[model samples]
Target: MPLYDYQCSRCGEFRAFRPMRDSQLPQACPECDVLCERTLSAPFLSGASDGCLSRPQGAAPGGSWRKMCGFGCSGAGCH
Candidate 1:
């Protein structure tokens, strides 16, 4: 089952866990009992599945060691 994200118009932030089969159904707001529309959340990528961003490989600045140029957490905020 895929967990989906939903925002309550009455409340604030909330998430609804629904299977892909029932993804199209309307849901009742847990706060005001009104029908709240489901919003699409950003896709979560992890590890190697993150495509090109998986590694922060880039060129090194002039005067820097070549070893420091390869894949590393130089300034891409890997940490």
Candidate 2:
């Protein structure tokens, strides 16, 4: 299974992952109950033989953390 990041359309931020065949919907927001979006992401902690490095969310391509956590925009897009 791959680790993924998901943002709540209603709430804020959250992370999630499951079987590649599984659903990508959030049950509820840690802050509030709302839907979320799934974002395919890059490796957060590279357990490579070299060393481990933590990349910030929305970083570059390979070093980037996906933000499928719903629309980060405000206004009517709120779930």
Candidate 3:
């Protein structure tokens, strides 16, 4: 199962874990009980990587590199 984001017109946004086969199907809003459509949102990729590290050219200073790069870090390459 994968977590998918959904948006309800009356209740705003929420997440649900479901099968990929049912990704296109509408999900019930947990708050309003409305059948909301799936929304296209960025996937959460914390600690996910392809064994490559590419630093941003002009990234702002003073933030978690793991958050900025979406990869786990050991306090290296982060200022």
Ranking by lDDT: 3, 1, 2
Pick the winner on TM-score between candidates 2 and 3: 3
Backbone clash count for every predicted candidate, in the order shown = 0, 5, 0
Let me know the TM-score candidate 3 reaches against the reference structure.
Answer: 0.56
* Reference-based TM-score, model 2: 0.40
User: Please, what are the lDDT tens digits per residue for candidate 2 over residues 1-79?
Assistant: 5545665554444555456666455434434556666655655563322211122344333322223222232222122
State the lDDT at 77 in candidate 2.
Answer: 15
Model 2, runs deviating above 4 Å = 23-27, 48-79
TM-scores of the candidates in the order shown: 0.46, 0.40, 0.56
Give the whole-model CA lDDT for all candidates, comma-separated: 0.45, 0.42, 0.59
TM-score, candidate number 1: 0.46
Q: What shift in Å separates residue 38 of candidate 3 from its native position after superposition?
A: 0.6
Q: What tens digits encode model 3's per-residue C-alpha lDDT throughout 16-42?
A: 778999999999876567898988878
Model 3 pairs in collision: none
Top candidate, metric lDDT: 3
RMSD of each: 14.7, 11.7, 10.8
Model 1 clashing-pair count? 0
Write model 1 residue lDDT over 1-79, tens digit each, in one string.
Answer: 4545455555544445568888877666544566666776675333332122212234322212213322332444233
User: In model 1, which runs have C-alpha deviations exceeding 4 angstroms?
Assistant: 44-79
